[model samples]
Target: MGSAALFFFLEPDNALLSDVNGDLVNAFTAVRDHPIAVHNRLKKLPTGSDSYYKTRAVDPDELPPLDAAARFIYLNRFCFNGLYRTNTAGKFNVPYSPSKTGRIPSREKLIEVSQKLQGKRILQADYAKILGSHVRRSDFIYLDPPYAVENRRIFKQYGPHVFGSSDMEELASCLEKIDAKEASFLLSYAYSREALDLFGGWTTHRVYAQRNIAGFVKHRRRACELLVTNIC
Candidate 1:
């Protein structure tokens, strides 16, 4: 649920939002349940290399839900390229991004998001389990799994257990199950041979997007993405 951008765009009345990132899920919950508290906490955070590193050094688990959520938002806003890469020890090691303005989302925005998230089920669970248990006929599912190109090294942002080629196979199987259940779904993935092979015979469209995961602008490039859907 990288940003859950599509979900915000659609804004359906009923939905189940799930991601494998527990911190992200907790942040979303905090925002939904205590937007004012989170916003107040965020307002107290100072923005600078010293402040950023000091906040990063503190374990989010040691803080309350609102503080943890605020810390997550602050780090995400100031981290390198806005990436969430962690070291082998599961420590968020993304360096400070001087380019970022170090501005947190507005209180109004958090309240608006909180309203949108109300009555929606948010959970930190595997995609397969969420898809298997919650999907039903006529449901519209949007899948944006982590980039997993075969025989290539990409930024591993989701920690050591990042999605890999094997997980892509499981995602394909999940797609098949969704198709069998007669639910319409769309999948956005990096345009690669593995993606093509796994999701062939679907309505696929190629699209270009700016790659920002690179730590420097010089390394950024235009990347092709595949939009595979099963809607008539």
Candidate 2:
């Protein structure tokens, strides 16, 4: 089970909904091993096409209705590895792995997800909505934003306004509001002290995450991430 799936399992009482901004949602699609199919289907771009790979926009009008207990969020699609960078126009621009390995598209799992998520709301929107009027007291909020520290200065990582310090502060304020409401919530972030300071009073725990490194051999790096929570 993946993070999105895990969310459903953890909060079974609440309806499941996700706001996938980038191509991470492609994980729910059928797996395709062919080079062309992988390139076109997962990345949403034609091979050799001038248009660089970018995150596809989801229309808000097509979203489902939210039950009172439903939790909402903008999820980065779960591509094979969790690459969550975007382009200037807020498009997903992660490159493909040369391994030629087919991803587990997990149709049955997604269909299960769909069944469990019936009447739940998931749509692409600004973070403000996630922390806005829609979110209230007693809600269980979880935030899993991009965690790479290098995103700050890397030219390749720069996007319109995907994730940054300002976004972090805004999230902090949101969390504070949630806290005021006595809602249960958990946040995942790079284990940076600054991040800890942002979410005052929340206890942090370390979790091992296997992340991908950009290279030909397809290396995996075991790194530490922080999980801050108010639900204990």
**Best by the lDDT measure:** 1
What is the per-residue lDDT of model 1 for residues 133-196, given as tens digits with 9 covering 90 to 100? Answer: 9999999999988887865456366787879777988988888899999999999998989889
State in Å the error of residue 73, model 2: 19
Candidate 2, residues 1-232: lDDT per residue as tens digits? 1246456667566533444343332222212112223323333322221222222233322432221001011122323233445667665555543233223334454345555555555544565575665666678777776553544342234355666665778777777777887777788777776786776467778898765532222334565778888887
lDDT of 2 at 60: 21
Question: How high is the lDDT of residue 179 in model 2?
Answer: 82
Clash pairs, candidate 1, are none
TM-score of each: 0.94, 0.62
Error of 2 at 107 (Å): 5.0
TM-score of 2: 0.62
Give lDDT: candidate 1, residue 170.
93
Off by over 4 Å in 2: 1-3, 20-84, 98-110, 148-159, 212-219
Regions of model 1 farther than 4 Å from truth: none
